[model samples]
Target: MFAVAADDCAPSDPTLTVQAYTVNPQTERVKMYWQKANGEAWGTLHALLADINSQGQVQMAMNGGIYDESYAPLGLYIENGQQKVALNLASGEGNFFIRPGGVFYVAGDKVGIVRLDAFKTSKEIQFAVQSGPLLMENGVINPRIHPNVASRKIRNGVGINKHDQRRCLLIHTGYDEERRVFAEPAGDKFL
Candidate 1:
């Protein structure tokens, strides 16, 4: 796998802070979680990290998918090759229902982003999470998204490395733990 130079990823807007980590399915242990084995929901990232750390697995964690009132994933959620929740294709308010929403998945040592209509189940898929508006695919941004739209909030997405198909970047923007705004919403361009 190849690593892109940091200069290539420098955000256009200096004020919009982006934190990213490179993940390769073959070298790193990537898993999705929403609850404990005891049937209690891990309602927040802090709670999930604490639980994992208590078991001596102190590692980075993030919550980028949408969840409902009970914290259950609103779309497809899989764990260790088992589907926990089926894909969601219903009409709804907000970003989840945007046309051509997609799934981010890990299959064996590879990762992929595919439009919901194009998603398929396979034995090779180790983990998957459905979320979107399928921002961009194959170097093209989804046409449904406005280029200069003012609507913004804390958001995150996975991007495949152009240099290495197996490598993916977990990207996030907006406020930090202390509630400081990193990516201002009013900017003309993306952070």
Candidate 2:
């Protein structure tokens, strides 16, 4: 439950401090946390890819941001014996992976952790699991993708079922990396 909050635009504060913890080295996932100068409370802010050098130490950069977004990652700055961390997704830091059941706030253009396991399909709709069933950002839901299992097409001058058509496409596209997904029936492939 150790956490840290960070924002680049925040003014000087005497109380807040930034913290980081190792999550998974193989995945380069590191958890960042923040706390007050008076040691009252603390919480997690985000997880980022830890760039490590040959010495196996995190390459702490004064500049940080999301991988796909335009933003600057900020560290802790203490003030007024209280803590204030920026949660701006587009301007400060990168995307955050929130723990399931973890507390968070999502403003406009903000993305949060998504949990897919909680999704309940109605009337047996077909869908595929794209990612975690844990925490999700806003507008994210379960079954983001559908397992392409079959297709229909004319084969050998005979009309074939979707599944059969998929098999033919798979054979044709097996070696084609770019056309592999669309070349065959989508249902036949699974990630």
Candidate 3:
């Protein structure tokens, strides 16, 4: 819910942005924070009171939207000039390993998504996250997704405006099929 940006940050800068979300399991409340890299303070963004089940666990949290089990990213993760988890090329389990799962990255003044194979050889990535079944690729919805599929779940994805690298988009599709959700631009919205 919170987003941070440096006063005069650019993509080439290592400390461009940071976003954090704290989820309280006991209270089922989620708080978001955003701050610029090296900033003195974090700004509160959103405090969401999530619905909990009888067991005191969030009933319908968005899975795969944030951290995965063990608090590790479900796909490739890169930060602070280091690759946290190598690009996953093998088809294993989960949506993350879906064939052709792609990487969303920021480098210099550019924001883009490329197939994992291509990302492995790239030398300019500054930050990145890998996610599967790309909702869209090269300006088109992935052919793998069909409109009539019976199975539907809350889903989220990132997109960058090809015309302007600085303008990025975060899309969250809730369980309801009739409504569309779009988020405003944030420093690390793609992440």
Q: Please write out the lDDT profile of model 3 over residues 1-191, one tens digit for every residue.
A: 21213232122223422222222222332212222344322221122222113343332222222345345555676654467666666667655655557776666555566777777635666567777766555555555555555445556555665655454544445464311222223323332
Count of clashes, each model: 0, 35, 0
Candidate 1 Cα errors over 4 Å, as ranges: 1-16, 54-59, 176-191
Name the candidate, 2 or 3, with the larger lDDT value.
3
Root-mean-square deviation (CA) per prediction = 6.7, 20.3, 12.7
Q: Candidate 2 residues 1-191, lDDT tens each? A: 11112222121232422211212222332223233345433322222222222343442222111112222223122122222333222222212332222121121222122133343322221111111111112323213223342323211100112322211100111121221132223332211
In candidate 3, stretches whose alpha carbon ends up further than 4 angstroms from where it belongs are: 1-68, 121-124, 150-152, 177-191
User: Which pairs of residues collide in model 3?
Assistant: none
Lowest summed lDDT window (length 10), candidate 3: 43-52
- Cα lDDT of candidate 2 equals 0.23
lDDT of 3: 0.46
- Candidate with the larger TM-score of 1 and 3: 1
TM for every model, in the order presented, reads: 0.78, 0.18, 0.55
Task: List, residue by residue over 19-92, the lDDT tens digit for candidate 1.
Answer: 66666666666677777899888887677766566654433456756888998889998778999899999998
RMSD, model 2, all Cα superposed?
A: 20.3
Model 3: number of clashes? 0
